[model samples]
Target chain A: MNWLKYIGIFVMLLFLQVFLLDNLHWLGLVHPFIYLWAILMLPIELPRWLQMFIGAAIGMVMDLFTHAPGIHMAGCVMAAYLRPLMVAGYVQDIDRMKGAITITAIGMGNYLRLLAVLVVVHHTIVFMLEAFTFSHFGFTLLQIILSSLFSYALILMFEYLRKNT
Target chain B: MRNLLQLILRYSNFLLLLGLEVVAFVFVLRGNKYQQVAAAGAANVVTGSIQLMSDNIASYFRLRADNAQLLEENARLNAEILELLNGQTRKRDVNDTLSTRNREPLSSQEAPYIRADLDYSFIPARVIAFSEDRHHNYITLNKGSRDGVTPDMGVIGKDGIVGVVQSVSTHFSVVAPVIHEGIFISAMIRKNDYMATLHWHAPNTRRAALEDVARHVDVQLGDTIVTSGMSAIFPADVPVGIVSDVSLGEGDSYYDIDVALATDFNSLRTVHILNYTHRAELDSIQ
Candidate 1:
């Protein structure tokens, strides 16, 4: 039953990422990658290997959709590896079955901080790899900042909606 | 050995992360040049089908705009046909003797006056995916190798030139649109025949620059620019754009001309791919 729920979430996130979020070219700058929600919402106590594998799989799917083969996979893998470190101090006890390591369970402030750090880290690596050089450093940095903020805001909104409902 | 094994086990997660990242980096490196082409060919097979499905749904909402553009093109073509017919009738009435003379075999000196029939055919294709947000924009079309689309074939929309086909799969082709920084077409001012090269400079979709026209040419705002047909890819006299602005750089020998492009790429849906029959012969001779 628990595995079924995670699989369902994975499929839903993949569909949303490929069909919806990837197509939204808002201002040609901020592409809200809310698909990261799947990795971010994983149970805090999940095995690191499994989490990293899931992140890489999701990233590969995104890369296939965007016609960009590997940059997203690299970024997502990095994010998955760093996930525990980001939430280590805040998440004292992780509920495995409920898997409520989300914003509602972790408090808003700490959740936002975790979201910001991970998003920035992911976007920075992704954009840098996409650019492949420091020649367009300013442009790449701007993209990373704008896209991270946009993704953070979208995740926050979803968290609020889930809490209220 | 025991200590080393324990250390490896303790940091196994980090090692796993490194291994995955290395694999991803390999994928990126493989996507650099020649390998990237192969990857894109494979990627297109999957992405093309998905784009085709999405385009089917999205095309419904764009029917009105597409219809208007087709109507406008139809009207223009009708006017051109009427003009041609009128000129033919007037020429027939003006000179029966001269018309008879025109039928006679032309001398070697008059060979240049003989016009060869256009050797081009068009294959219609619908745009399944288009992006103008990037510095290097690409357009994906529904027609591909199976439909006779090949690399370097010119694509034109209703209003003007779109781009050249860059790559092709079994059922899809990718176009390097004129908006891409790398695309440059030989163009000329319609009024004076001053030749230049058209290329995208600004990020705006509706604008591009015409370069290399001499400073002495009387270029003005609102002057029409058309393809020069120097390259056999596109036919001559296809409308490219109107000159929106022109300026001379200090101490420079050429004019910096800005053109408002004829094709509105944002609303592009359907295009015609030009197939030049004599392209191989011409290429071989060149």
Candidate 2:
């Protein structure tokens, strides 16, 4: 039952991203990577290696769809590896927590911090690597900021809905 | 071996993180090369089928526009055929003399209509995927090796040049389009034949920068740009764009030019992938 629920969410997020959210790049300026929800809501107690593996796998799927090759994969792996640190920093008593990382799993203040940092980290790596140069650093920075905000907001809304429903 | 196994077990998490990142970065750095080794791996095959399905549903919306364009082309081709038939009756002797002088006797193996008289052939392909918003934009076509779409073949839309074929899979080919910074089209001013290299500067889809034209060249607004034919990919005089803006810095050796690309990439649906027969011949000399 547990595996079925997680897999269902994973498939749904990717399906939405590739078909709908991808085609709907907000105002043609920002791309909301809603698929990151799959990685974000992974079981908090999963082994570090397994989490990174799943992250890279999702990134690989996105890279294939977007024709980005390694850009998203690199971002995903880094985000997965660093997420534990961010979660630990926010909630000191993480051992008491179980199951997925959700708003209900942690308080709102801590949840927001965890989500914000991870989303920014993932977006920054993906965009910077896609740009591959600091020559147009300002433009790239603007993309990172706009895209991160859009992705962060979308993830927050999904998390909120999950907690309520 | 026992010590090494124990050490690996002790830091497996850190080791795996390092290992995965290394693999990811390899694709990042190597993906952009001409070979596009990372472009169509097994994963792309999975996504390619999904894109094909979506494209089928999406293509229905564009069917009316596609029909109109087809009708226009059909009308033009009919006119050309009618004129050719008229010319054949009126001046058969002249046509025979001029055409036979440069040609050998018709070979038995040749199918007259399949390959055009020119050195190039074209495979009609529909765009299955296109991305212009990204820095490294790629266009995926529905044709591939099975359809004879090899790398480096030129792709052109009804309006103008699109890009070169960069990678191929069984059923899909990826194009490194003119909108990408990595692609540089050798273009020339059609009026004066002044040549320049064209590259896409980020943040805009409709415009690209034309560089290396000397300041003294008689370039102007609305001047035509076309492929230079310096390379085998695209034939000479294929319309690239019309010059939209041209400016020269004071005492600068070259003109700063902007071209409104002929093809509206946002609405690109179909492209003709040019199969240049003599590409190998040209490559051998170099």
Query: TM-scores of the first chain across all predictions?
Result: 0.88, 0.92
Q: Tell me the TM-score of model 1.
A: 0.78
Which portions of model 1 show Cα errors greater than 4 Å? A1-4, A22-24, A42-50, A93-101, A127-142, A162-165, B1-37, B88-116, B182-202, B209-225, B228-232, B245-257, B282-286
TM-score of each: 0.78, 0.89
Q: Residue-wise lDDT of candidate 1 within A1-165, one digit each (tens)?
A: 276887787778776766677667666666667877777877767787888998899788777665456888998998888877667777655433346457666778888888888888888888777667776577777778988888888878877786788
User: Judged by DockQ, which candidate is best?
Assistant: 2
Chain B TM-score in candidate 1, rounded to 2 decimals?
A: 0.77
lDDT of 2 by residue, A1-165 (tens): 297998899889988888877776454468778788788788878878898999998898788888767889998998898877678777777666568887776778988888888888888999888888888889888888998898999998888888888
* lDDT of every model, 2 decimals: 0.78, 0.81
Over B124-180, each residue of candidate 1 has an lDDT whose tens digit, in order, gives: 898998776555567889999999998899888777888988778999988888887
Clashing pairs in 1: none
